[model samples]
Target: MTIQVLPEQLINQIAAGEVVERPATVVKELVENSLDAGACAIEVELEAGGLNLIRVRDDGGGIARDQLALALTRHATSKISLLDDLERVASFGFRGEALPSILSVSRLALTSRREIDQHGWKVAGSGLLDDGSPQPAAHPPGTTIEVRDLFFNTPARRKFMKAEGTEFRHVDQALRRLALTRFDLRLRLSHNGRRSFELAQAEGDTARAARIAAVCGDEFLANAVTIDEQRLGLRLWGWVALPSFGRAQADLQFLYVNGRNVRDKLLAHALRRAYHDVMHSQRHPAFVLFLELDPARVDVNVHPQKTEVRFRDASVVHDFLFGAVHQLLRRIRPEPGQHHRVEFEAPAFSTPDPVQSSVPLSYGRNVSTPSWPVREASGASGSAWPLYRAGFAEPEMPAALNATEDAPLGRAIAQIRGVFVLAENRHGLVLVDAHAAHERVLYERLKLQLAADGIASQRLLLPEVIRVGGAEADQLEAQFESLRRFGLILDRAGPESITVRAVPALLIKADLAALLRTLCGGADDAESAEHFNEALDAQHRILADIACRAAIKANRRLTVPEMDALLRDMEQTPNAGQCNHGRPTWVQIDADALDRLFLRGR
Candidate 1:
């Protein structure tokens, strides 16, 4: 092929291919330009998903009449002028290719007036246009860009457009992402003459939370925990949902870096590692986090869309983000006197067999020993009955034990079928799954101990040998050291066989071959390898399995004292609201709900 300079119009259309993939892309570029222009209020109007018409008006500093034509030319921008400016760019639109590339494929009309100008000037452009003369026009002291028939000149690109509704959803998502970063600005969006949303400027923390609730959902806000941490010149603040509130997909995760939305692999991995043991395997945690640091410490020009960033010190950033989220999740204990209730429909009734019911049954003596003395009913802050009082021995009894109603999980009254614990509090009733609750408590304790002191290993009497395929063996060999950190000692018996000589004391009862196979299978890819390394390095998964094995099982009878001790432990344990499997450990039924069920005082 002969080398020749391509036409400016062709060059621009090619650039447009990179910058404008759909109507949403067009909206992103234009809105970013407006943001860089210092717009506090931006309004967007779309028709036919922006294929037919897209009008964006922003109350920002407008262009002068003399510069209206220059604005249509490629590579002209007021945001940056030097290499230093590019190194530490704070503006959203620094390349100045958005307008010209957009103009190359659409019919664009730009009208603007500076604050000092009495009237605005209008300039119109079509396909392959280098410039357009500014004509006198009457307008406000801001800018309004009207784009019509996008990709009209490029018929092939137009053919690739999706349906109107799908396109509109993309535009809506783009707007939502931008809205999260700029709570101080007002954003209004309308589609086909119907207003989609009109968000006012958010001022304080309360208002910002309200805005987040409006955008994310009310349920997310109710289940989320606030986070604020600063260290090593980095600040991360946001709300992360409780482990039980996790979603099936990661669509709800919104992360921002220095006021710009980014989708980064390092950040995602850090978050996943932080919630490794606490969350279920099939679920993803939801969060809206913002990380702030000096501009020079990060690079945002890795992609044309600017949705991925690179940190100068990735390990430090990773550690900081992981530590912040991990600490926040670790401190999520249920507050005293706090209660939550969920209502369910009444169960259907079944007729009992009269003959079976007529038979009399003999009863045995109750095993519960009520010898421990109970204090008088005090306020919410009353001291709890100590679990370790005199090494579980029964103390001298009082006449009656007054169980207060102010406890968060209430005072245990009975064990239902040796599985659920029934309690009474300020709320109507509380039911807790003893097995799941104990599993979570033990899991957290194991994690703490593992963090403080490394996992203890048990030597096997005889080494167990297993054979595997060549590919699996290669992966196992590559991650041999990482697996050893989790207390799984291995040696290469042959090319396709390995011998396990020792295992973590906690996981001694677990299936050794299955776990090794899983680790090897997951190490086939880089991302999965990193994930497995982190989990094994912390021995989190192994600890979870151990906790499950060591926890109290269902249908295991307990004394009143043991039941009370379990309740007290749950109240003090972090993240006790959900078990290792992400299922809720306990549920509350409020007094009002009980009243409604019986139609009392009607």
Candidate 2:
């Protein structure tokens, strides 16, 4: 091959290949152009899933007559002129290659009538980069671009296109993404002359929520949390679905930087970490978030498809995103009458109120009487169940909240099946997994203690010995300090043996010997020390195990006060909605729903 610069037509075709991967890509590029043209109302028409024809008509600022031909030329753009403009370009089609690229591989005709013009001008062409002199044509004030025979010049590219239905689905999905990101714009799509969907412009919180329901699905909105936070010139606003309303894949996760939808890994990683503890394993959280920041702080020209962006200080952005979402999610200690869509429809329990009354919760007796924490086995030494199990016997807790409205979990009414706690709140019925709730409470306490003065360690009556591989023993030594912080005191006896001198009080009953072996067995020495101490799932598993074992056992009887105390603790706990294992801690059945079930209204 001779060393030669590629011809303009071939170059444009290559660029088209980069952005236009399939019918969906064509829709994306064309619609992006329409958006950049300041289109408020845009209609996307497709035939044969956009393979045979794609027509995007928009009511916006249209190209002028003299510029009609220039619009078909590569690199000719009205979005940015100065080099600085490229750095802070706000428009979606600043590159200006989308038009010429699509024109190179397909038959393209652009017709537009500027606001000042009485008649429209049309420039029609296929490949050859020919501007083709504009001809006068009557058109409404706006722009209409007709693209036909996509990839006609390259049969191989057309062959890669999927079946009609599959392709249309892709196009539909793409349009939906755009609609969600640009809620202020009206977008409509039609396939084979049949209207697929038509979204009207959405304004205000209620209207935006309606748009979200229409585009992302009503189920998602029903189960999502609305977040609007602004700090240091960064604003993150949108809906994040509850952990229970997850997806099998990340298809429903839509993240837009400024106003452009992108797939930045930093943002994705932060979201993952935010939902890490609450989400079920292998499930992806669904969200439609828009992050707005100083345009100069983010570079949008990082990827060819413009689906990724680079932040000037990526770590700052990541932390801000993570903190905002993480804090909001933690603060979401369910409002009354509203449980996540995973189960029961109604308001759910929330945090505790400071107003307390000395009167005992009424489950047929005075909660003021200390009747529940009758220590059976061990006494003070057992912090696991050490000083009285969650009960009415609490001399430490001041008093239980009197009003049902104040007590979000409501006054505990009774215990059921030794596993669940049945309660009545202002909203309606609230059923709680006693074990799960206690487990979460204990887990949170343990973590807080771990963060504060380090978990209180209790010396074992007798040291437990464990045997492991030589490499495992080495790991045990390396992570000794890190383990010590979690209240694990270890000593390496030999190349394959170690002794556990003391354990966290909560884990006193756990099989320390076996658990130690598991923790040390698969230890990744290659991992960073910070990550090893903080992000290790194995470390969390150990704590979770301790909480699980220490939690109120199934089938145990409890007094109203004991149950009330547990509910109070749950109200104060973060992520109290779910247990350590991702199972919901409580479910709410609305009083209205209960009435409807019995036909009370009828």
Candidate 3:
């Protein structure tokens, strides 16, 4: 090969290989240019998944008649004039290669009218058309860049493009990041002749949050917590949902660097670190963070799509953002109680309310007879019901550990740490965590009651008003009816807070502020009244710090009769060994494993 200068079109196609990866790439470049030009209103239209046609219009400062030609050429951006400007490039778009790269991959057209000019001029990317073509244009100053037949010349790149719907999703995601960062702008996006989204004139972050709620829905908003903090010269502000609010996939995370949307490994790692103890490894949190810093310290031209940026001090930025978010969450949302629901059998002789009666009842191996309920009538006199209720006698002989299918589970072998009750069965020995078993029992009972009619709620004597964030405020208002069912009285207090007058009696002693914050970041429909109440109850179960006190704990002694009753309760539970969090409440170790460990068997 000889050393030679490539033709203009050939050079452009080569550049397009890096810059114009897909329709979204084209949109990103053009939109950045519009934002750089200080456009308040941006309109984007695409056809055939941005293959056949793509157009971007912005009410930005347009090019003059003489400068239009030079703007099409490579390395001719008006964003910077001096070399010093490169180091201090604060604009969303600094590199001028976007226009030239896009023109290379498609049949491109740029038309603009300056504030001083009456008409706009059009330039064709395919050199076949003249530069100064007279076209019918609009009045105010703005720029319109139209691209047709994207990757028409390159079949390999076109083959990699996804389906129309999939491509549209990328476009929507990109637009969402931009819209979230720029709340004051009005953005309109349409694809395949259908208007997908339109954000009209957002006033502030509040308006912007509402718009995001509409787009991402109330589920995300309800579960999202505000993140606003500055350290080490980097400011991170946005909304992040709790770990429970996360999706199975990392689809909801949106990060912005300065004003440009970028995805850095550091950002992802920082987020993973922030959610280290809170969320499980399989789930990803829903977060939208906007990072603001001096642009001179970061290089946005590191990648062709301008998505990955290089920072002057990567460690400082990472530590600050990660630590700030992590600490805030930890301080605000301490560990909740182990589980939510609790179940207890109604006393045959007494009907004391569980919430009100805190006096411990006496228990022992000796079964006590009812004091005043000895009067019997009809055919049920002196039946086995009293023995079963008192947990003293079995109706039939106990089955062995290796019994046949027809055999029943034997008497309780032991209760470990008072929390778990162990019983011998035909095949094996079963160990059950009493709290988890009881929670399952209660959850089922409550669900049934809800399906039939509704759960009964007790109002508070004095309504307790707890302040909540704006996102949670909206969610509380949206899910008012459902929260009422959970015995929560939520009312909007201000622009960014809600007042909680009451909560589920089960969570009365909980840290109300933290619980509300935790609930705000859930993934289900917080918009629906039912979902809101579900969130409250779920939070009470998962986030309230009452489980330790209410739940049966290890080392607490249990009588033989109590152990027998606990075993029976475990048998009725659907999932006996695990809690709602998928953590094992009890483990199973067979005789064979014990024999093998002891070298008693081959």
Candidate 4:
């Protein structure tokens, strides 16, 4: 083949392959252009899931009559003029490829009139036309881009589109990402001739929350916590759902960098680490967060779609994000009446079966029946019953109990079947899963103790020799020192085997051989070091299991004082809102809800 220069039409069509992947990509590009044009009110109209037609109208500083044709020319942009300008580009459409690329693959008509112009001008183009001349059109002091027959010139790309609903959903999601950051702008979206949503300009915090509720859902807003923090020349503000509000998919996680929606892995990793201890496995936390920093400090040109960014100081950003979210989650206490508002509904418990019944509920070894203190017919403790034999001694009530109205968890009133603690405060009633609450308390305390005193090593009476692959043995030898941090000591017995000398004192009862094999199976490369850290994380989970075993279990009868002690401990402990498994430990039922249940007001 002879060397030849590609025509302008083919070059644009090729660029479209990178810039316009689907209808959603077109919507994202056009909407971003409208935003960059300083549009306060934008309307997006779609037909056939944006495949047949997509019209975006905006009231902003429109293009000039002479510049209308330039807008459809490749590499023509007004956002940046010099190399230094690209380094600190802030606008969403700085690349200048969106318009030309989209125009190449679709039938596009750009009509605009600047505020100073008396009449608007229209310019239409397709892949066959390089730069169609602008002609006189109706009056409008803004821009309206009408794109029809998307990917019409490229049959291969058009055939790859999904079903109508699926494609529309992607477009809706793209609009939502832009909507979350620009609360001051009014955005209206319509699909298949029917209006889908119309978000008005939100001016206050309450209205902004309403906008978020409209986009994410009322459930998210009901369960979310508001965050506002500024530090180190960075500002992060948004709402993060509580750990109990976790979702099975990460679809609801929206992160905006400097007002541009992005899905950077660095941010995701930070969020994962922050929620690691509290969130359930395979569950994702839902959040709508906005991060703002100096534009020069971040690079948005790393990806074709500008959906990922590279930070100059990723470590600093990671630490800042983790610390901010971690601190907030740690101090999260259950709010009054929060349980009844959203998805945090309390689990209903039925009354326990009669103690004298012939069939006693068997919960296996994990649960034990509590020995009730022996009492005389007069209801006084018998002289033969020793206090120490009761399992727990009652502590003196603090003076804080005098003001029960101000108590966060109220005051414990009764124990239900040794599994639940029922209490009352200003917020009507509070029900607590006694076992789950105790488990979290013990786990937190154990972690703290471990951190303070370091991992305690328990020597094995007999060294266990485990066989493994050559790579596994090599990894075991290489990661010996790192393994020591988890109190796991290993020796290379041979090319295919390793000897385990000791394990964490807390995991003495665990199957050491099985755990070592699991650890060895995860070591494959340098990144596999993270797997080693995760193995150590497994040790903490084992510790959690131990705490669960030691915690007070179901069918354990507790006196009022003992219940009060547990409640006080829960009130003081950090991250006490949810258990280790991400289940809420306690729920508050407001007095109004209780009244509604009984029709007391009526």
Candidate 5:
């Protein structure tokens, strides 16, 4: 078959498959366009989670009447000039496919006017001919894009759409990611004609941070750590929240390459690696990192959606980011809050006599009191037994054990295991899993340290030499200096195997060869020495095994003072409520729950 060009409409629909996954996809694309247009103020209005309508109005450099038609044409972009421009692409809409792709799947309308133009023009779908030509009408200087009936022609796609509320949540998420990246830009969002959220334009970093807090919630801002660092000409600036501040999952974490929002495995790994040892296995850290580098150094044209990119020096960038965040954490450690210990006094051991006083108390007796005792016939004794009697069944009652106030909760009354300290509290009982408690306590402390002082590492007795395998080894050898800064001293020991002489003191007892091999084996294909070192540093910070060793063991009878100290320290520790394994360190039981269990009341 002879090769022929595909129709523009068909080509655009294909592109749409890549750029538009759902209503949120449309919102993301449109908002990115507004941002690229230098819009300081943008408003997004949604209906049916953008399935029925998505209107985006922006006060940016709007398209001219002549360019309005071009804007709707696939691959016709103002962002690029030649093939070389792909390497230096910076704008979020560099691919030039979003507009056309959006238009293909929906009834699209665009109204735009350049600031210089007296008025704007409106381009309607009616002008789109069978051959893909646009006829424009008159319209304003700013741009307003209206998309209606998304995926109407694609019934299969429509069928996959979730309920309206769930879909709206996705759209809300998309807008949030974009908004966080551009704090300087005022953003407004509404759903089905109702105002939901708005962010005022911010000027300085502080203002931007405050705006972010306003959008992401004040709790996030409170736990976030500011990062600012330069590596190989790349500048990293942004905030990363403490692990305690993260969502139940990683969905809340946002990353921006330059100013464009992106979700990439590499970035996520870097973040997780940064918090590896400092946080529990299930918990995640929230971060918003903006990487600024020369436009020529990165390749943003790798994908039409432009959400992922190829960095010129990815190893350097990864290390820079890991270090900056790691350092920020070290400087500002959030402190822990203290918890008070409660003790419950048990009843006396001696059983009381089974006797009922015949006389009634004048002070407590009520006028409705019965004149005689209510009794039930006893089957065996043929005698009346007081049914409503109190303290009358002495033979059936068990003797109570006495406890002294001076007795340690961890010794006389409770079970203290390897990492758990179980004790009886005032209301009921408390199980203090020490490892978990310490894990959470340490996590909070280390998180504060990471935020405040970055991570602290003890220098090794000798520099560790990690030999790489083949060409990868060469890459590592070249970035030796950068590796040293991260605490992985590497030198070419052999052709394939780098000799391990010394590792960071944090892993002195760890199998050095295995650790180094794991680091090298897991590295990206073209990772440099700097990258390996950064990875090693991140690995070093993970102190789960070590922390477990240092943490108090459960079942071990702790002295009253020790238990008191542990309780005191844990209460003061941030995030100490949960353990390193993501389990709660302690549980609360109210007096009502205990009384019900004991059958003490109705």
Candidate 6:
């Protein structure tokens, strides 16, 4: 058979397959066009989950009466014209296929009237190349695209559509995704007859949070932290929920490039890596992040739907996003007055390790660690409170000096249940998980020791041999040098076995076989360099195990002075808000919360 050009209608329908999948895609494309047209307000009405009807009305720059026919023509886009324009296209809908492609499959009616026109014009069609001309219609200084009986002409495509309720949910999600990107635009949606949502134009952070709560939920808003970081020609600003508030699935995660909503893998990987240390393996971090950069730096024409993009320097963007989010989660310490709120700083590209860099976690008068008055104790466990080992505990305090200011986390008053430490701060009552806090403190110290002179390698009495898969042995062979940095030396004894010659001096007491299994847990899959760096810099799960064992055990008796000393150590530790497993080490319950608990005011 000889190749031949397909019919114009068929060609449009085929192109539509790439962008228009179901009612959701149709809603998304129409709304994207409205946004590019500079619409300040958009109202979308759906019938039968947008299969029977999808009407989108936008108060934007309406098309000219003469160009009404051209609007139904393929490749006629007002967003871009030249190669240069295509390279750095800023608008959402640039390919101009959304209108004609939808027209070929559905009964489409376009109505518009510019500000200068006396009345609006309407053109109706159910085909790509409609010969009908625009007719005089009622007045309106905006544009409206009414798509009726979507896929009515294409029965085969319509057959693949999901159930009515499922399709409507998808359409609702599409509208909300767009609404999140543009807070200035008042986007409203209606299903069947009743209103689904009418999002007002939000201005301030409070309004933004309200809108987010409306779209996501109130639970997300309560635990969300607003972030705004600008660095090296890129700015990322939005809300990221705490790790504790993370979800089982990534449904609530919304990301936007510039102003257009997108789902890029590079962006996803960067954000996931940022949450690697804090969140569990099965949990997904919930975030609404927007990354902004020069238009020339990103290409939005990677697909007809414009949902994925190609960055000029993907590594740079990845590092910027990862560093910003990673560092912010670490600095989530309590601030004066605002107890749970997090303050954002322009994150530097290089996220420095607090122990190695200039975080100043010294045991001297450099910044003066708080000195708590010690009460005399006579128990045998008194000596056990301060663990003595390699890379543990500095010299005892240089006498007690009164703190000049009331610390964010005030002095510890008592220890209860042998598991929690109760402290009295200016911000009411503060409860801390004693074991979790101590684990974090020891973890940071371990990292500091590893970074300084390298953890001393402890040789086993008889080199313990552990079995493994052939692939695991191959990877172990390649990563020997990196593993040695953490004082781990391995040898491939056979095709499916590995011999461990030495272990980290700090982890000598840990079960060596279990530690080896945990380190090589997911080493089979091919990972990116960033992921490799994460694994190499800190294979934290193993370190966390060591820290857990070395931490102040629960049910261990402690005097007031021993507890107070632990509290001071927590204040100086980085990422001290959470333990290595991402569970929060401490929580704040202010006076108001306490009052409400007892119904005092009521």
> lDDT per residue, candidate 2, 114-141, as tens digits?
9999899998888754535789999998
* lDDT of prediction 4: 0.77
lDDT of 5 at 164: 92
User: What is the C-alpha local distance difference test score of each model?
Assistant: 0.77, 0.78, 0.64, 0.77, 0.62, 0.76
Question: Which residue pairs in model 4 clash with each other?
Answer: none
Error of 6 at 228 (Å): 2.5
> RMSD of candidate 3 to the true fold?
23.6
Residue-level lDDT of model 4, residues 158-211, one tens digit each, is: 899999899999999889889987999999999999999899999987789888
TM-scores of the models, in the given order? 0.81, 0.87, 0.58, 0.82, 0.62, 0.83
Q: In candidate 2, residue 28 scores what lDDT?
A: 90
After superposition, the stretches of candidate 5 with alpha carbons farther than 4 Å from their true spots are: 1-4, 126-139, 334-543, 546-550, 554-602
Ranking by lDDT: 2, 4, 1, 6, 3, 5
What value of lDDT does candidate 3 attain over all alpha carbons?
0.64
Off by over 4 Å in 1: 336-340, 343-407, 452-538, 600-602
Model 4 clash count equals: 0
Error of 1 at 42 (Å): 1.4
In model 4, which regions exceed 4 Å deviation? 130-132, 337-403, 455-542
Instruction: Quote the lDDT for 567 in model 5.
Output: 52
Tens-place lDDT per residue, model 3, 1-602, is 79999898788778778888889878887887888788999999999878888899999888887777678788888888887897777887667777887777788888898777878877776632355555556646899989998888788889999998788788877787778767778899998878988988767766766876756666676546677898677899877765545588877888888877778998888887776544555777788788999988888767777779888998998888888776655443111111111112223344557896775543211011101011111121121111112234544433322323422233467777666777554434445566664443344334444555554444566656666656567776787776565556777778766766766454555566766655566435453333344533343343222332224446666655555555444434333223444343443433443344334533
| Comparison by TM-score, 4 against 5, better one | 4
Could you give the candidate ranking by TM-score, starting with the highest?
Answer: 2, 6, 4, 1, 5, 3
